[model samples]
Target: MNAAYAQSSVTLYGVIDPDIVFVNNAQTGRSGGQLTGKQQYSMLDGTTSAYFGSRFGFRGVEDLGGGMSAIFTLENGFNAANGTLGQGGLLFGRQAFVGLSSASTGRVTLGRQYSSLWDFVSPLAIITQWAGYIGSHPDDLDNIGGTNRENSSVKYTTPVWNGVSADAMYSMGGVSGNFAQNQVWSVGVGYTGGPVRLGVAFVDAFDPNISMFGATATAGGVTTNNLGSLGSATTAQRNPVIAGYASAHRQQIFGAGGSYAIGHATLGVVYTNTRFVGLGGNSGPNPFGYSGSSTITNVEANVGYQVAPAVTLGAAYTFTKDDGPNNQGARYQQVTAGAHYLLSKRTDIYMVAAYQRASGTNSLGQAAVASVAGLTPSARNQQVVDTIGIAHRF
Candidate 1:
């Protein structure tokens, strides 16, 4: 093999993280399926790690003469404890995309993929950094954690110019006779200069339950055509933050974030606005009896510090509020703190904790309850979680 022809390569990578966790005010069912609150302790996989989820992936690149290349990525999410597929049990559910790239031009990709908001703006959000899964806003309604992905999508990214870049994505509805049904689109712009980074993004989707938030694909590369399983008021484990609006016909999200580094410390702030429009209009049962539109706002600030070469610390605060039809709403406040110590290049030990408080009315038309993104909603208005974990990468 000549050296010139050896420009193609494929790489394998993965991460595994396991944790012992404690949660207070967890809701559980009693003997007769009665709902009651209790404190629980358990071992979980990846949810408390610095990366948020455990995953394995393969990425490849092939040179195509000039300054262009062919690229592809197949990533899988899994639960380390149970050896089961993550992301609703779909293989390669984290990401699966193939595309072409040019040094002077840009890149375009197709397949199941993340939205522009996740790619560009989330980097500055606390959840993308040390805050990890426990820091998500309410039910992660804004998709800041990449929990929601688009199917049957096409994406384009521009080459960086003087530390500035932009990208756009569109997901086809794939429905006969109705091109706009289940459609999703997004756009974002980012800037990186010195120790400062900033981004802004917007997303719009029709029938969001099927297009983005609830989109599900199979191992055979087929996506679900209808709204998947939905949460209802009677569902003991369902999050109350935004469950009532599950039948929303459309959804819009806009967000902006920035980070500034001052030597060993970095400060970040983010804000997002989300709207669930035309509820009770989708092709699913409206169990929560929601109508019209509901609006949500989230604001967060965080700081990370490198106290030593192998030690890092982080803290964050977030406030989320929802304004629904006829002024119905809920409010949430959360605080998180974490510490990490690197044991080696590919391993680390960490501890993270968070507490949340809620008030007003939840989407279930009942009293608001605290709920973290990965955990079940609490039986009361306050909840607390603590976790200690170890992570390894290869």
Candidate 2:
């Protein structure tokens, strides 16, 4: 087999990240906004990117005459510590696509893929990009870190032209006779000139509630007073804040980010607005207990420095606000810091920490708990986490 593959070049690559983590005020339940009063210590598994979720993929490229090429990639994400699948247990959870490329034009791929907005703008997110997912805005609610992946999707990415590039993507909902149901569409544009780069992206997703809740329902006469009679299944969510709005008919996000490099330091800022529409209707609880439309706005800024040849440091802060019906809303303030030490080109060690505070009520009128992206909700209104991990690329 080794000799048989001599003429072909295929590479396998991935990153494995694991961390020892400590959390203060971790939520004990899956949903319902209940919190624990004690601090918790544990490990960050393959489900999260404490340093980075472990992943490996195979990729191949073949020249196809003048300025063209054939390419394919099959990637999977997993928990580095437990050796389990990530991204909801899909086999090729991270990515799987095949396409042709042209130097003069662009590339097109069809498969499950990230939205254009996420692909183009995620790297500019100072918190998620450098400080880790624990630094992400509340719940990673806007997906500014590209947490949501689209299935049955097609994407096109244009070649850079005068430091500018563009991307577009559409995902099929796969619901017969309902083309837009659970569908996702996005577009992004970026400009990179010297040390300064900027990106703007927009994303629209239909039937967000159905996608998040894993079912479709018609709210017949669910109201506030009898909400407790619906039982626990509908309110079973990973995050209470997001669960509250799981009844939303649709979701939309607008994101913009920019970064500048000066000397050994890079400074960046990212902003996003996310809206959940058509909630608070007469919808019976299907999964989440409450139904209410809401909007989340986030702003973040960060800076990174190469303090030494093998060492780097970064810090970021994010502010988030939620506006919803019945005046049930919340605000979050988060701060994070991290340091990375390079041991080799494909290996590095890092330590990161984050702290967040929350205020006001969540979707179910429960005290808003501080929860970082990719992590569990807090039992109280504030939370802290710290991790140390190593990552390897191969």
Candidate 3:
């Protein structure tokens, strides 16, 4: 072993985000006619985690000499509010990866990692950079496909050149006999100069089975299928008749953003568009089809000003629209204002408020229920939320 190789360091990092929230006309349970049997409910709801759905991670690099280095990271997400693992009870839910890199050839890493869509588009939006609920496009369609993350992935990121860079990732199914099920791939490119940035990305998932409200047949007879029982079956068995719906699942996203400084204030703007096709499944006597092409467009603008050396004030507005086959469509608009006070470089206190309104038809043409998967509602049958919180990173 070389003397230089023995000198290596590992670091720990995490963030805490907790907040108080209020929702108007909230439904207690899942959709469908049996919705808690209650008309509406309202209460003080915690928006973020109590402490922070915080994450702890370890990262290290070893010098192999000759300009070569080996690196790895293991990150876990925990609910600071209740001290439980996040991401549906998966350990190291945030990320886990190992890789090798060189000054000459960029880096190649293998493990669970963020897709290129989020890496390229998230930073461009003020809502995403500040408020989690507000920053994401309806359901995070522009960020990483609505709460879905790639697993068993191999990624490559090229070093920056002339303010431009690129990345590609492929997720493996890891199914022994069947190879193509639950696989995903993505590619993206970005450029940044001054205060302007632009990005483009594409994502494709093959036979990525998803669960929906439907029925399944068993030896006993027909039964209402829920997520629990559906998880026990294979992709082929879960929605056998609609298997074609899962084939060639794809999404494409493109965005542009920029900021300009003026005196003590900076103004920013961002725009994004996303397209989805061939998703959802239903196979039975009562078949409900959710597969179709859809388009989502989002636009946002904001201004930030330094109130004092330690205090910053910001305000932003966002608009989103979704158009789908048939009459399934939705529109959302939001306004947000907040202030941050820096107690130290790594610690801060902040307060923010956002108001959102949505209108449209749900998948089933239910007038009261607006079909927007994630966003603020306009009425009781719609979705609306107001949140205030604080975050600290270390």
Q: CA lDDT of each candidate? A: 0.82, 0.73, 0.56
lDDT for model 2, on a 0 to 1 scale? 0.73
The all-Cα superposition gives candidate 1 an RMSD in Å to the true structure of 3.7
The candidate maximizing lDDT is 1
| Model 3 Cα lDDT, one tens digit per residue, 75-111 | 8876665677765567887789999988778899998
Highest-scoring model, TM-score: 1
| Per-residue lDDT of model 2, residues 247-344, tens digit only | 56788889999999999999999999998877743222434444556788889999999998888889888998888656569888998988888999
> Which candidate model has the greater lDDT, 2 or 3?
2
The stretch of ten residues in a row with the least summed lDDT in candidate 3 is: 212-221
**Structural similarity to truth (TM-score) of each candidate:** 0.92, 0.88, 0.77
The clash count for each model shown is: 0, 5, 5
TM match of model 3 to true structure: 0.77
User: Model 3: runs farther than 4 Å from truth?
Assistant: 1-6, 29-53, 144-146, 175-180, 208-248, 279-287, 368-384
Whole-structure CA lDDT of model 3: 0.56
